[model samples]
Target chain A: MKYIKVAGVVVFLLLWQLAGQINPGIYSSPTLVVTEIVRLFTEGGLLGLVFGTVATMLLGWAFAAVIGVFTGFLIGRYRLASLVLEPYLVALYSVPLIAVVPLLVIWFGIGQTFLLATIVVATGIMLVFPTAAGTRETVRVYDQVARAYCVSGRHFLFKVLLPGALPFIATGMRISVQRALMAVIVGQFLVGHPGLGTLLSDARVRLDADEVFAVALVALAVGAALTALVGWADRTLSAWRPEVTS
Target chain B: MTLAHGKTAAPTRLAALTGPGPVRDWTIRVAAFCALLLAWQLAAQNVSVAVLPTPRRVWEGMAGLLERGDLQLAWGQTAVQVAAGMLLSAVFGVVLGVLIGWFKPVDDAISPLLNAVFLMPRIALVPLIALWFGLQDTAKIALILSFSFFEIFFTVRNGVKTIENEFVEVAKAYCIPQWTVLRKVVLPAITPYVMTGLRLGLVYALVGVVLGGFFLESNGIGGLIYALGSDFRTAELIAALFTVMLVGLAVNLGLHRLENLLAPWKVTR
Candidate 1:
C-alpha cells in the first residue's frame, strides 16, 4: 500500500510534467514549481508576503476566538439569549462571508484593516456553532455535578464550564484557522493587498503559471502548518479532559 | 402553609423566566431584531453613507435593483450556475467517493492526492481556472464544482468507511451479490452523509458562484456586488449582500427540512 501510494504520486508528477511540456503556458510541472518557489524566496520577497498574510490571519483569528467563545458561552448558558440569537448566528454562519468582502473593502478601504476585517468576518462566526454546542453539552452533563459540589458563579464558569468545553472550542479553533487562512489569501487577492495573494495575482497578470503554482504550494504549506498547530494546541489543552471525565 | 406556597411560587416564576416558550421566544427574537436595526440606524447616521448606508437606503437600493430587473436577472444567472454545478458535483463526487472508499487499490492510490488538493484553498485556484476556462459560464460552473465537490466526496467516502464490516461479511456468507450488498448495506449507511454533503455543498457552491462572478465574469449577483462595491455604491452593495444571505439562509433551512424528512434518524448539524 505504501509503495502504491508513492508510485501513485510519482506517476501523477510524471503526467503533470508531460502535460507541462506540451502546454508550458497553462501547465506548471513539479520541478518548475519548485524552482519558482526557491526563486520567490531568494529574490521575490516571498517571506514578507507570507508574514503579512499569516500575521493578519492570526490576529483576526484571535479576535474571532474571543468573540465567538464569549458569545457562544452566553447563548449556551442562557436559554433566552439562545432563542433570540441562534437563528441570526445560523444565518450569518451560512452566508458565504466572501460575499461581504467587497462591502468590507468599501467600509474599511483596501488595506490591512480591510484584510483583517475580511478574515474576521469570514472565519469568526464559524466558531460560534461549535463553541455553543460544546458549552451547552458541558452544562447539560456537568451542571448537576457542579451543583452537587456547591460550585456556582464565576468559579463554575471558569473551572467547570470552560474546561469541559475545551474540546469543542479547540475543534472550532481548528476549523476557523483554515477559514482564516483562506479569508486572508482571498482578501489580499481581491484587494491587491501586500501578501502572497498579491504575489499570486501578479503572477496571474504575468501569465506565470509556474509562479502561481509555487505560490499556491506556499499557501498549502501555511494552511497545513496552521491546521497542525491548532491540532497540537487542542491535544495539549484537552489532555486533562479524559482524567476529569473518568 | 402560606410561606411554603410563596417559596414554590417564586421558584416556578424563575423557571418560567428561564425556560423555553414559543410566545416568549418569538417576542425576544422580534425585539432583538428591532434593537439591532436601531443600532445600525444610529451607526449609519454617524458614518458617511458611502461607508455605511442606512437601512432605509439599503431598502431603496434593493427597490431600485428590483425596478431595473437587475436583481432578478443577476440572481437567475447565479442560480442556474450554482444548480448546474451542484448537480454535476453531486453525481461525480458520489461516484468517485464510492469507488475510492470501496476499492483498496484505488483508495491507496488516490486518497493522498485528494487530501493534498483538499488542503489547498480552492479560492487560490480561481485565477488559474479563469485562465483555463475564460470568462464564461463554464468557468463559473467549474469554479463552483471545484469548491463544492470535496465536501460531498469526503463525506460520502468517510460514510462508506463507517459501514460495518460484519454487515458485508454477513452478506457474503449469505451469497448476496456485490451490487446488492452495496445497495443494501453501503448505500443505506451513507445516505446521511450524502444529505450532509448536499447541505454543505450548497453553501460552498454559493461561495464559488460569487467568486466566479467577481473574478471570472460579472454576470451574476457577485458581479453586481463587485460593480457596486468598486463604485462605492454602499447601499446597493449591502442590498446585494442581503440577497445572498437570504438565499444562503433559505437553502440551509430548506436542506435541513429535507434532511429531516429523508433521514429522520440521523440528526445532522
Candidate 2:
C-alpha cells in the first residue's frame, strides 16, 4: 500500500512536470520549482520570515485552543449557556475567516494584533463544537459516576467532562490547525509584509511563479507538519488518558 | 463537527439578574444578545469609526442600502451563485461518494488521488480558474462548486461506508433489487451524514461564493468589503462584515431546520 501510494505520488508529480513543459509561461517546471526552493532557502533568507509567520500561527492557534476548549467544555456542561452562545458562534463560523480578516485589521492593528486575531478567528470555531459535543456525550455518564461520589461541579467539569471530551477536542484541533494555516495565509496575504504569505504576495508582484509555488509549498510543509505533530501527540497521550486527570 | 452546534445558541450577557425556569431562559437569552450589542457599542467608543463601526451605523448602513435597492441585487447575485453551486455539487458529490463506497475498485482508484488534490490549498486555484473562465460569474460558480464538492463527497462516502454489511446481507436474503436496495436502504442509512455535510456546506458555500464574488462579482458584499478594506474605510468594513454575519446567521438557522426536516429518522424524543 505504501509503495502504491508512493507510485501514485510519483505519477502525480510526473503529470505536473508535463503540465509545466506544456505551458512554461504560465506554469514553471518542477525542476525550476526545486531550484527556486533551494534559492529561497539559501539566498533569500526566508527562514526568518517563515518563523515570523509561523510564530503568530502557533501563538494564535494555541490561544484559540485553550480558550475554545474551556468555553466549549463550559457550554457542554452548562446547557443554558451553550444554548445562548450557540447561535452567534454558528453564524460567525459560517462566515469565511478571510472575510473576517479585514475586520480584524480594523479592530486590531495591521501587525501582530491583526495576525493573532486572524489566527484566533480561524482556529476558534472548531474548538467550540468538539469541546461542547464531547462534554454532552460523556457529561451524563461521567456526571453519574461523579455524583455517586458526591463530586463538585468544578470536579465534574474539570475531571470528568474534560477527559471524555479530549478525543473530540483533539479531532477538532486537527481540523482547526489546518484551517488556521489557511486563515493565517489569507490574513497575512493582506496584512503581512514579513510572513510567508507576504512572500507569496511579493512573488505575485514579481510574477515569480516558481518562488510563489516554492513559498506556498514551504508553508504547506509547515502546516502539514504542525497538524501531524498534533495528531501524533494526541495518539501518544491517548493511551495514557486514564492515568491523567484535571 | 461540534463547530456547527455552537451557532444555535445566543451570545453572553453581563447582567447579573437570573430568574427561574423558562422565563429565565428567555430572559437570559434576550439579555445575552442585548449585552453583546452593548459591548459592541462600548468597544467601538475608543476606536475610530473606520476601524470599528458602531452597531447602529451598521444597521443604518444596511437600511440605507436596502432603501437604495443595491442590497437586493447584490444579495440576489450572491444567492443565485450559491444555489447553483450547491445544486451541482450535491448531485455530483453524492453520486461520486456513493460510487466510491459501493465499489472497491472505484474506492481504490479515487480516494488517494482525490485526497492528494484536496491537500493542495485550492484558493490558489482561483487564478487558474479565473484564467480559464475569465473574470466572470462562471468562474465564481466553478470555485464554489469545487470548494463544496469534496466536503459533501467525503460526508456521503462516510455515510455509505457506515452502512452495515449485515443489512446488505439481509437485503440480499430478501432479494431486493440493487436500485431499491440503494434508494431504500443506503440512502436512508446515510441521511444523517448527508445532513451533517449539508449543514457544513452552508459555511463553505458562502466561502466559495464570497471568494469568487469578491474577485469577480461586481456587486456582492464581499466586493464591498474588499473595496472598503483596500480604501481603508473602517466603518464601512464593519458594516459590511456585520451584514455578512447577519446573513450567515439566518442562512445557518434555515439550513439547520432543513437538515432536521430532511432527516426524519433523527427522532430526538
Candidate 3:
C-alpha cells in the first residue's frame, strides 16, 4: 500500500512535468514550482505574506471560537433559546457567507478590517452547530446527576459541562481552522491584501504559473499543518474521553 | 432515596422543555424575526444609507431589479452554470469514489491525489482556471465543479467503505451476479450518502459560482452583486444578497425533503 501511494505520487508528478514541458506558459511542474518557491522565499518575502494571512486567520478564528462557544452554550443549555435560534442558525449555515463579502467591503473597505470581518463571518457560524450539539448532549447525559448533587451555575458549567463538550468543541475548532484559512485567502484574493492571496493574484496577472503554483503549495501546506496541529491538540486534551465515531 | 424520585422527575421536566410544540415554536420564531427587523430598521436609520439601507429601500431595490429583469437574467445564468456543474460533479464524483472505495489498489493509488486536491483552498485555482478556460461560462462551471466535487466524492467513498461485508458475502453465497449485487446492495446502501453529498455540493457550488462571477467574466447574480457594491448601491446589494440567501435556503429545504422521501430509514439532520 505504501509503495503504491509513493508510486502514485511519482506518476502524477511525472505527468504534470510532461504537461509543463509541453505548455510552459500554463502548466507548472513540481520542480519549477519548487524553484519558484525558493526564489519567492529569498527575494519576494514569502514568509511575511504567509505570516500576514495566517495571523488574520488565527485572529478571526479566535474571535469566532469565543463568540460561537458562548452562543452555543446559551442556546444549548436553554431549550427556549435553542427553539428560537436554531432555525436561523441553520439557515445562515446553509447560505455561503461569501455572498456578504461585498456588503462587508462596502462597510469596512478593502483592508485588514475587511479581511478580519470576512473571516469571522465566514467561519464563526460553523462552530455554533457543533458546539451546541455537544453542549446539548452533555446536558442530556449529566443533567440528573448535576441536579442531584446540587451542582449549578458556574461550577456545573466549568467542571462538568466544559470537559464533556471539549471533544465536540475541538472538532468544531478543527473545522473552523479549515474555513478560516479559506476565508483569509478569498478575502485577500478579492481585495488584493498583502498576503499569500496577493502573491497568487500577482503571479496570475503576470502570467507566472510557477509562482502561482508555489504560493498555492504554500497555502496547502499551511492548511495541512494547521489541521494536524488542531487534531493533535484535540487528541491530547480529550485523551480521557472514550473514542466514539462521529 | 431522594435520588430515585429525582431521576423520574428529571425526564418529565426535560421533556417539557425539549419536546415539540409547533404552535409555541412558530409564535416565538415570528416574534424574534419581527424584533430583529425592528432593530435593523432602527440601526439603518442611524447609519448612512450608503452603509446600511433601510428595509423599505431594499424592497424597492428588489422591485427595481425585477422590473428591469436584471435579477432574473443574472439568476438564470447562475442557475444554469450551477446545475451543469453539479451534474458533471455527481457523475464523476460517484464513479471515482465508488471505484476508489471498492478496490484496494485504486484506493492506494488515487486517494493521496484526491486528498491533496481536497485540502488545497480551491479558490487558489481560480486564476489558473481562468487562464485555461478564459472568461466564459465554461470557467464558471469549471470553478463550480472543482469546488463541489470533493464533498460528493468523500461522502460517497466513506459510504462505500462502511457497507457491511456480511451483506456482500450473503449475496455471493446466494449466487448473485456481481452486477446484481452492486445494483441491489451497494447502490441502495450509498443512496443516503449520495443525497447528503448532493446537498453539500449544492451549497459549495453556489460559493464557486459567486467567486467565478467576481473573478471571471461577470454575468451571474454574483456579477450583479459586485457591480452594485462597486457603485455603492447598498440597497440593491442587500437585496441581491437576500436573493442568494433565499435561494440557498429553498434549495437546502427542498433537498432535505427529497432525502427524507428517498431514504425514509435514514434521519439525517
Model 3, which residues run further than 4 Å from truth? A243-246, B1-21, B164-166, B174-177, B267-269
Better structure of 1 and 2 per DockQ: 1
Leading candidate by TM-score: 3
* Candidate 3 positional error at A39, Å: 1.0
* Candidate 1 stretches greater than 4 Å from native: A144-151, A242-246, B1-20, B164-166, B267-269
B163 Cα displacement, candidate 2 (Å) = 2.3
Better of 2 and 3 by DockQ: 3
Cα displacement (Å) at residue B106, model 1: 0.5
Question: For residues A1-246, what per-residue lDDT tens digits would candidate 3 score against the true structure?
Answer: 899999999999999999999987788888899999999999999889898788888998888888888878878888878878888888898897888888899999999899889888898887887788889899999999999999999999999999888888887887778788888888888888889788767866776788767877887788888888987987776678757223
The true-versus-predicted C-alpha distance at residue A48 of model 1, in Å, is: 1.8
Candidate 2: segments with Cα more than 4 A from true spot: A1-7, A26-29, A77-80, A133-165, A203-216, A240-246, B1-19, B45-47, B127-135, B164-166, B170-192, B213-219, B266-269
* lDDT ranking, best first: 3, 1, 2
lDDT of 2 by residue, B137-235 (tens): 787878888788888888888778767484777998899998888888988788877777766665787887766655454456666677767777665
Candidate lDDT scores, in order, read 0.85, 0.73, 0.86
Q: After superposition, how far is residue B243 of candidate 3 from its true place, in Å?
A: 0.8
Q: Model 1, A1-246: lDDT tens per residue? A: 999999899899999999999987799888899999999999999998898788888898888888889888878888878878888887898788789988898878888888878887888887787778888889999999999999999999899888888888887887777788888888888988889778767866776788777877887788777777887987787676643220
